[model samples]
Target: MKRVFIEHIESYLPDERICNEQVEQRIRAGGFDIQAGLLEKMIGSEIRYYARNDEQVSDMAVSAAQKLLHHYPDRKIDLLIFAAASGDLIEPATVNIVQQKLGLTCPGFDLKNACNSVTNAIEIASALLLNNSYKNILIVSGEKTSDSIKYTNIEKETIKDHFAAYSFGDAGVALLLTTTTEDKGLFYQRHQTFGEHWNLCRIEGGGSMFPNDASKLVFSGDTFGLKNVIYEIAPPFVKDCIQEAGLTVNDIDLICTHQVSKDTYRMVAETLSYDVNKIMQTFHLYGNTAATSVPIAYQQSLLDGRLQKGNIVMLLGMAAGINISVQLMKV
Candidate 1:
């Protein structure tokens, strides 16, 4: 079987830089009194970007994909997959919009499972590449989480159910995967979803459940409840991923874990007893960018010299559907 490897990865941030204080001010502007510095103090995130009013998720995806194509001009994409926790529209799938915007003629579609969308895309793309279905696969995600922020109805007593939205930061990420001759690629990939906890974090609208309920469109979540479930399942799975790969935590060169807040990010480091330095830190700068967090970590790790060719890299994802996925690969 042919192996799949990530050829290149890139991330794009929106132009507007919004900090914690600004988030609070926006909420206050909506006729709600909110305190400054509380968001940063609670979430441990200082800054995040917001896409312009005119910019759609497709536009941001195109920006990241264009940068990727610019760096590798000779490559041809055989498949395009747009994975996102949030997308441009309600119907006709977002991937079509992305493909048309990028002027790509290849087959395209979307795969969504909250923040695990990109990770799921990678799993499907890997299978396609290994089975000789596609030579080059481009997986992209653009999350305009600012669109889901509930600036009003933020009751202080029930804040846990709505607090994750405050950390909503917009970002775009693109990843390229292709068949490689090298034996090093995916070693072990595992995924599990606890449907029982689906309500722990979710948006109540945009589906058959509430097709026309415009008021239910904003994000609703129980960050503490979600984190508690992660604390129970995620750590053990990380250990299992390492063991299944015939390695130990010390053997992995880099572990890129998706984190929503500073506290959840630290839990990974603390639970696994792994070096905090080995994991990429993006929460402080980008917050939880939905599905883009892991790929953003991948690109940043490469830029910071923590990742190199032939290194064992692990991608750990924790998403809202209470989904958790771990992929061990060599790059």
Candidate 2:
């Protein structure tokens, strides 16, 4: 079998930077008393990137992919896979726009399994590499959650959800996966799904099932948005993925779980008996960037010099429909 390794990773965040203190102020102004330490320790976010309304999800993805290409100009790319939930437009796959924007001429498409899109795309890319179908695959994950945030509904009792409103930021990430002879590539990957939990997290508007109509112009209290569903199912799914990877919590040198929140990270880490020190978190600094979380975390690790050759790294992802995917790679 051919080994598939991430050759390069890059991330692009919006220009606006919103820190935790600012979020606290915003919350306090609305009659909430969330502590600073709680935001730091629980949400694990110091700041998050925010994009302007004009900046679409595909735009960020293109920008990140361009950065990757700039770094490795000579590298030949054979495939591209864009993964995201908050796309620029609903009908045309985001990858189509990305392909045109990036000037990439290859077999490319979009993958959507909620936040797990990137992880599942990696699994598929690895299989393609093993079969000698593609030499290099570019995986781009981007999310613009700011577009969907309903800030009008903010109150003390619903502050946690409001925290979700502020907690999620926009960002894009691109990774290059290439085939190699060394074992330092993709070692193992497992995909699992619990479709019964599909409705747990979703955007009810602008889709065929629930078309955006005049009556649906305004969101309601029970709209079933991001906050209500993600918090309910993420923790357990993280544990299940880690366990299925066939390694103890300690076996992974670095854990790059989804960038949901600090509390969710701690809860999942505690459940798996993994030390907090072993995890790489970008959510606090970058917010919950949906499909882009893992790749952004990967790039941040590279920047921090935490990821070295021969290190054992695990990529854990959980999406709506309660989909869970875990991939083990030797750096």
Candidate 3:
């Protein structure tokens, strides 16, 4: 297979910054008594962002993609992929909207895999770039998770299911990938899904199961059960990826991850005996932006100089559907 290099990467976070106090305020607006500092304490996210009411998912994606398209004005995109767990519509794949909004003539499609959507897109695009004539593929993602929070109906029994929602933040990320003759690109990637645990996390409405029920639109999940599974699978799972890549934890210069909870990186650091500084902890700052989590953190690493050209970076992801993936690459 031919090497696939990331030509460029960028992110677009909404202007409206939200702190844990704001999150608590909104929840309290429902006239419910909630423990203060619960979100930051449990989720470890001090701040997250929400797009304005008029902003759509496509808008965010286009904003991110525009940065790349402008950076390389002479380059042409042979293909485009919109990968995300959030979108502006249920009909007409989000990729179509993104392509149209960006005014690109390239063929495009949508890919969804809960929080690992963008990582999966990169895997697919790498294969296509290796085999096909296309020189470059652009992947973009936007998450508007704030739209799904249910502040009003906070029954104590069902509270367990909604805590995960508080950790969610909105974001957009874009990556431009192309075939490379050099070694700086994706080399090893693996994904495993435990479908039986799919019921642990979900947005119950907007699908055929509960089509007409608006109340089912909010995020709901078994947090304790999900964490149990994470602990069981993630440590061994990550060790496998690093071994298969013919590298050790020290060989990995940076770790970009889809943080499903506050303890996501904490678990990785403890299980692997790797330095905590090597891990990118976006959950505390950006919250879980679903599919954008890993990519945005990857972008931040580049800007912060923690990762540089030819550095070994691991894209670690754990999403709903009980999905987990590890992609080792050079940047």
Best by lDDT: 3
Ranking by lDDT: 3, 1, 2
Error of 3 at 214 (Å): 0.4
Better of 1 and 2 by TM-score: 1
User: What are the TM-scores, per candidate, against the unseen true structure?
Assistant: 0.97, 0.85, 0.97
Per-residue CA lDDT of model 3 for 193-254, tens digit only, reads 99999999999999999999999999998878998888898789889888887888899998
Q: How many residue pairs clash (N, CA or C atoms closer than 3 angstroms) in each of the candidate models, in the order given?
A: 1, 3, 1
lDDT of each: 0.87, 0.75, 0.88
| lDDT of each residue in 1-331, candidate 1, tens digit only | 4578888898899999988888889889877787777887788856899999999999988899999999888778999999998788877889999999998999999999889999999999999988889999999999998888888776778666778888878999999998777777776788998788988888888888998998789888777878888899888987987888789899988889897888765788899998888888888888779999999988888898887778999899988877889998887
lDDT of 1 at 81: 99
Residue 214 lDDT in candidate 2 = 37
lDDT of 2 at 92: 81
For candidate 3, the per-residue lDDT at 34 reads 82
Q: Which of the two, 2 or 3, has more lDDT?
A: 3
How does candidate 1 fare on TM-score? 0.97
